[model samples]
Target: MLRRSGLQALQALLELARHGQQWSSVSAIATAQELPAPMLEQLLLQLRRAELVESRRGRQGGYRLSRAPEAIPVAEVLDAVGAPLQLSEGPAEGSDGRAETQVLQSMGQRLQNAIERELKQLTLQELLFDLESWKEYLSNEGGLMLG
Candidate 1:
């Protein structure tokens, strides 16, 4: 969550899937996203191991998604990159007085669930288009509903 690599991987994969259509060198992706090269390398390694992405070697060598963006759920990437939520095991003091802690834990779980739902359904193509559209809107109107 703090690292942002999980989301970054999703964006990278989706962008490559949508636009690359062939090979997308990591350097290009890193430059485009303005992400650190070393970090990108590490993330790409993790994605490769998770089978979410595959790489080619040589001049035309680069990386691409192993499966369709729609097929690769954001939840899957989150799991592959990091645990859903940083949930510690429930307290050992299982008692009625622990209701407050339980409530907090439940709330956390709910938040994680909501995030997972959004990520799982959001395809790479959709995200890319949304970003491009938002940029255009911001540039043109400078605000959502300019008066």
Candidate 2:
């Protein structure tokens, strides 16, 4: 349930990680991921401010990861982009105070907590690894079917 900007930020970071310390222009990442360049540019600036990404200015200058991908957690990226992990807010004011409402609110809070915990544990490197594995699996399956 990530906002578009949050998803774009993750995609941009993954692209940077794939390049392995190489500088990547906004246009390059935008084109590769089919994202809007202007939006991506702003997201990178936010990431830079968050200290998750480093940028340089020059002919060969662009953006790169500020630290190793393994050090950057998915929750950190979402937070940097202002995307809250919680899907909904707590109970509304002036409620009937029924047991059902209380139960539902408690369950919702528990779910949000679990999601936050998982996102914190997931690193950018792990995301990249999963993406690579999925691609490889699809390619292998395609080849087998064709052969």
Candidate 3:
């Protein structure tokens, strides 16, 4: 689903940049991630507007991360791509609904608070490092070494 496409795209771009990848078009990212061209294009536009990515305008032109991955956070990318996640009002005002709604309303607020707290704590640098470590581990279970 496109639900996580924006976040996924950001991760893909960060991974490619971390690997010294170079290509002249969105096709490169789309091909590498197996993402559709139109989808990648749409996300890329949002990224550009947020200044999270920049593109070159020539034969060797392609999109690239605009700043250090460490400087960006997953939450920021999500915000740039879509609306801020909000909690919903619970059930209608019948007796049972009111009873259930009261509890759900409190829980919803708590859930949103927790999510924002954690998201604020996460940094793109940490995410990228974790990703690199995972890929290395998978590719060389016994030989991948970190300094």
- List model 1 lDDT by residue over 37-118, tens digit each: 7888788888899998899999998888887766777667767777353445555444466778778767777876786678
User: How do all models score by TM-score?
Assistant: 0.74, 0.91, 0.76
Task: Rank the candidate models, highest lDDT first.
Answer: 2, 1, 3
- Model 3 Cα shift for residue 67 (angstroms): 1.5
All candidates' lDDT scores? 0.72, 0.90, 0.70
Q: What are the per-model numbers of colliding residue pairs?
A: 0, 0, 0
> Tens digit of lDDT per residue, candidate 2, span 11-100?
999999999889999999999999999999999999999999999999999999999999999999999999856666766732777988
Local error of candidate 1 at residue 58 (angstroms): 0.3
Question: Candidate 1: TM-score?
Answer: 0.74
| Local accuracy of candidate 3 as per-residue lDDT tens digits, 43-74 | 88888899988878888888877877767776
Report the candidate with higher lDDT, 1 versus 2: 2
lDDT of 3 at 65: 78
Q: Tell how far residue 48 is off in model 1, in angstroms.
A: 1.5
